[model samples]
Target chain A: MSILTALARLLIFPGILFAVPAAWFFLWVERKSVAMMQGRIGPPFMQPFFDFIKLLGKSTPQRTGVAGALMRAWPLIAVSTAAGAVGLLPVLPSSGGFQGDLILLLALLEVPSICIIAAGFTSRSIFGEIGSAREAVLSVSYNVVFLLAIISVAASQHTFRLEALAQAPATSLRWIGILAVLICLPAKLHLNPFSLPNAEQEIYSGPMVEFAGPELAMWELSHGLEWVAATGLVATLIAPQMAFWGLSALAFVALSFGIVLLLSALAAATARLAIDTTVRFYWQCTIIFAVLAVSSALLMRLRS
Target chain B: MNLWKRLMCYCRRRSPWLFHLNSGSCNGCDIEIVAALAPRYDAEQLGVRLEGSPRHADILCVTGPVTRNAVCAIKTVYGQVCGPKAVVAIGSCPATTNVFIDSRTLDGPLGKHIPVDVFVPGCPPRPDAIIEGVAKAAQILAERGDEVPEVITAAEVQA
Candidate 1:
C-alpha cells in the first residue's frame, strides 16, 4: 500500500469514523452489561449515541479563557490520540507496523491520561483539581506495574515490534504476563475497584465537574475511544494466532467485546477503591503479579 | 434546521440525565426518588441517570415544598441546567405546598419560582409515579421549542 492509502486508512477507515462508531458500540455494550448485572433492562442500545447528540446540541457552558482553551483542546486531543494508536495496530496483521511499535503505542495511550490530568488542573473547578490530583497519583501507582507488564510481552518475543506479538504464539508464561496486564486493565480504564478519579457518588464527576454541552460531548466521545483502546490493547496482546488470524475482524471485535463485558462486570460488581487503597493495592498486589510474570518469562527464556 | 430539530427531539427523548433537589421534603419523597433508581425501578435502565451537577442534567427532579432558603438554590440550579430541559415536581408539597402550606417558612408550590413541567402528586408518590413524571418530562423536553413550562394539573397527572 502507498503512503496515500495508509494515510486514508488511518484518517478514515478505523480512524475517527470507524473508531468512533466502534467506540459508541463498546459504550453501549458497557452500559447494557452494567444494567444486566444490576438486573435492569438498561437504556436503549442507542443511549451513548443519543447522549453524544444531546450534549452537542445543547448550548455551550462558560469557563475562564485559558481553561476554556484547554478544555476545548482536551476531547479532540484525547479522541484523536486514541484513534491514532488504533491505526498502528492495523486490523490486518499483513499490513502491520513492526516491533518496538508497541513502545509508540504505549506512549500514545499515555497521552489521553496526561490530557485528562491537564484538563483537571486547567479547568480550575475544585473537583477538577481533586480529580487531576487523583489521576496523577493513580498514574504514578500503576505506571511501573503497567510498564513491567508491557516489557514482559516484549520479553516473550525476540523483536520489540507490536506486530510480532500477534504472530507470536501465546505461551503459558506470556498468558501469565497478559493476565498480569489484565489486572491493571480496570485501573487503566478507571473501572470499579480503581474508579477513584471520577467516583460519581463521592466526587460528582471530579475533573469533568464543570464541563457542559459540546465540551462534555467531546469528553464523553473520547471516553468511548478510550474504552476501545483499552479492549483493543488487550485483544492485540492476547488474541489467538492461527494461520488466517486478523482476517476475521469480526472475531477480533467479539474478542474485544468479551473483554469489555468482563471489565464492566468486574466494575459493576465492585466499589471504587479509595486513593490510599488503590495506590497500596497497585504497589503490593499488581506489582507482585508483574514481578511473577516477568520472572517466569525469564525462567522460560533460560530454559529455552 | 429541520435535521437539527429532529436530532434534538430524538436524542433528548432517548437520554435524559436528571439532577435531584430536595426543596424541604420530609425525606420521604427523596427516598422514593432514590427507590426509582434502585433495582426494581432502575431508572437508569431506561436511560435516565441521576447526575451530580445541574450542568449535566436534562431534567431537574425536585421534591418537597419550596423552603425560604432553598427557593434561591432551586432557581439557581434550574438556570444552571443546559436547555431544552424540564422540571418534575416530585411530591404534593412541591405541587401545592402540601401540609407545609400553613407553615411560615414555606415558599413552595415549586411552579411559582420555576416553571414545573410535570408533577407526581401523592404526599409521597410511588417510585413508579416518580419514574413516570421524569419520563413525561423527557418527552416534553424533546418537543419543547422554547415552550414555557405550565404546571400540569392534578387531574391531568391522574389521567
Candidate 2:
C-alpha cells in the first residue's frame, strides 16, 4: 500500500474519524436498547455526545507527580490504540491488508485492558487497586477463550489475514468459534454478569474511581471505541461479502448494530455475577469450547 | 458567547450525572431518590444517571439532615466532584434540618456546609419531585460552567 493510502486508512476512514462517531452511536444503542427493555424513554439520540462534551467542560483536579503523568497517559493510550484497532478493520473490500493483520488487530484490541489494569494500580486508591486486581484476573481468564476462538477461526480458514478471513466462507467450526467469541464479549465490554471490574454499585468504576473531567471523558471514549472494535470484529466475521465499498460499509455497520442490540438484550436480562463465579464460568467455557473448536478445525484441515 | 461556549453550556444542561449522599436521613429520602431513578419515574429521560463516584457527578444530591458523623464525608465528597457542578438538597431535612433541628448529633441544613442550588421540600419528597429538583440543578450546572468550583478547604474539613 502507498503511504497516502495507509495514512488515509489510519487517520480517516475506518479509523479515528469513523470510530469516534461510531463509538458514540454504539453507546447510545446500548443505553437506548436497555432503557426500552425496561419500558422507559431513554435519553435523546445525542445524549452520549452531550455527555462527552459536558465532561470535557468540567475542571480537572491537579495531581502532582509521576503517578499523575502515568494517570493521564493511560486513557490517551487506550483511546489511540482502540482507534488504531478499529482502523485495522477491512470494512471496504480491496482495503489492501497484509499477512497476519488479524494478530496485529488482536494486539491493538488488548491495549485498552492493559491500560485499565495499569490505571487502576497507578491511581493508588484502595478501590482502584481492588478493581485493577479483578480486571487482571478477568483478563487472564477470558483471553484464553477469546484468543482460542479467533485462532480457531483463523485455523479453519488457513489464513491470519483479516481481509481473507472476512472473505472466507463460513463453516460449522467458524460458527462455533463465533459463539465462543460472543461468550467472551460481555466480559470484554464490562457489561452485566461480568461487570466486576467497574461495578458501579461495588467499586465505583474501579480503575476510573480517581479519574475526573477530561481524563474520565477519555476513558469513556476508550470504552466506546472498545465497543466498536470488539463488535466490529464479530460483524466482520458474520457479514456477507459485498461487491461494492459502499454496500460493504453499510452492511458492516448494520451487522455491528445488530450485535449491539443482541448484547444489550443480554445485559438488560442478567445481573452482575460474583468475581469467582465469572472467572469459573469463563474457565469452564474455555475448556469446553476450546476442545470443540480445536478438534473441529483439525478435522477440517485433515479432510482437505 | 461563542459557539463553543454555548455548546458547552448546552451539553452541561443535557447530561447531569448524580451522586447521592445521605448525610443521615432515615433512608426515606434515599428510597425516594431511588424511586426517581427507577423505571416508574425514569429520571434518565432527562439524562440523569445515579453515579457511583462523586468525581463523575455533575450534581451532588444530598438527602436528610447532616449528622455529625457524616459532616466530614459530605465535605470530602463535595470536594471530590469536578467543577461545573450543582448541589440539590433533597427532602426537608437537608434544607432545614426538619425534625432534627434540636438533635445534638446533627450538624445541618446542608447549605451551611455547601452551597445548595435547589431544594425539594417534603418529609420524603415523591419521585417526580426529586426529578424536578435534579432537572433544576442541571440547569444551574449549565450556568455555572465558567464559574470556579467552591470546595471545602482542608482547614474547613479540620474545623
How does chain A of candidate 1 score by TM-score against the true chain A?
0.92
Q: Report the lDDT of model 2 for residue B79.
A: 91
Clashing pairs in 1: A42-B45, A98-A161, A99-A160, A99-A161, A100-A160, A100-A161, B66-B108
User: After superposing the true interface residues, what Cα RMSD does each candidate give?
Assistant: 1.3, 0.8
Could you give candidate 1's per-residue lDDT for residues A1-304 as a string of tens digits? 5576577657765567678888889888888888888888887878898999998878766656776788889978987888888776645545533322788888888898998888888877788899889999999989888888878778867656776777688777677777877888888788888988887777778887777888888888888887887778778777766556445466668778899989999988998778999999989888997888777767767887
Q: Which residue pairs overlap in candidate 2's backbone?
A: none
Model 2 chain A: weakest 10-residue lDDT segment is A91-100
Report the number of the highest-TM-score candidate.
Answer: 2
Look at candidate 1 and tell me the lDDT of residue A186: 87
Q: In candidate 1 chain A, what residue range of length 10 has the lowest lDDT sum?
A: A91-100
- Off-target runs (Cα >4 Å) in candidate 2 are A95-100, B149-159
Model 2 TM-score is 0.96
| Complex DockQ, candidate 1 | 0.71
lDDT score for residue A156 of model 2: 95
